[model samples]
Target: MYYSTDYSSPIGEILIVSDGEAIVGLWFYAQKYFMAGIDDTVPDDDLPIFKKVKKFLDDYFNGLNPRIDFRLEPKGSEFRKKVWKILMEIPYGETLTYGEIASKISSKMSAQAVGGAVGHNPISILIPCHRVVGTNGKLTGYAAGLDKKKELLKIEKILS
Candidate 1:
């Protein structure tokens, strides 16, 4: 069973999901691929992982960079998992282009492929997929909407 809870963030209402022990998903309400791989969810705000995530988000919104040390179990393919791992390495308040991530992960992988994996990330803010930009430094392809992406970047002081 997947335990879940709701977080009212500056961006919007976010639904956080967990598989009892570790977080499995965190999706911006109605965002693209919302609840993509989840099933049999039960709302439980008191879950331990939910509480940790809430604190992490609170610190993030308060302009403090919180470490992502909590357990996470995002469901995805091996390639997507590799991409998400790279996403986690993106420093707070910094951005990387899809091409850059592709090169870091595998020379054979295309930027377009990396973009697809980034877009499909199950956990949104926690994975920091918003820290990715286009090759020309243009904000693009955020599953949670470009406006929210820009807002997150601005909150992190990456954008003015």
Candidate 2:
């Protein structure tokens, strides 16, 4: 079952979702889907993975490179999973464009396809989709909202 909890952060409120075992999503408060079709109730349990996600997020907000050790099952196609795995290789405090990621993963893949996979990332921060930017080094699409994207980039010290 999917459980959710609300957390207040420096950037904004966040909705944390877990499958009772692993956190599945971490969405910003301003996201339209944050309040849509989601059970906002969290069960009273010793959710270790959920707690880890919260802690990682807290450390990230505190300007620390959070050591997150949690399993994630991001729902997507094989190509999408390949893209997300490449995204994970992008070290923290660094940025890459879609074309760069595509080249790193497979020279045959197109930048537009890479961007599409990045946009479809369901696990958000865990997969580090925010690390991808426009080829021109400009901020680009983020499902949680562009403002939150900019905040994440800034917090990770990847943005000016």
Structural similarity to truth (TM-score) of each candidate: 0.97, 0.86
After superposing candidate 2 on the true structure, give the runs of residues whose Cα lies further than 4 Å from its correct spot. Answer: 30-46
lDDT per residue (tens digit) for residues 1-160 in model 1: 8888999998799999999989999999989999997767998989887889999999998889998778988899999999999999999999999999999987887999999999999999999999999988988989989999999999899999
Write down the lDDT of every candidate, Cα atoms only.
0.92, 0.79
**Top model by TM-score, which number?**
1
Error of 2 at 30 (Å): 4.6
lDDT of 2 at 54: 80
Worst 10 residues of 2 by lDDT: 31-40
Best candidate, lDDT: 1
Evaluate model 2: give its TM-score. Answer: 0.86
TM-score of 1: 0.97
lDDT of 2 by residue, 46-121 (tens): 5677677888878888999877688776656899889988988888999899999889877797999998888877
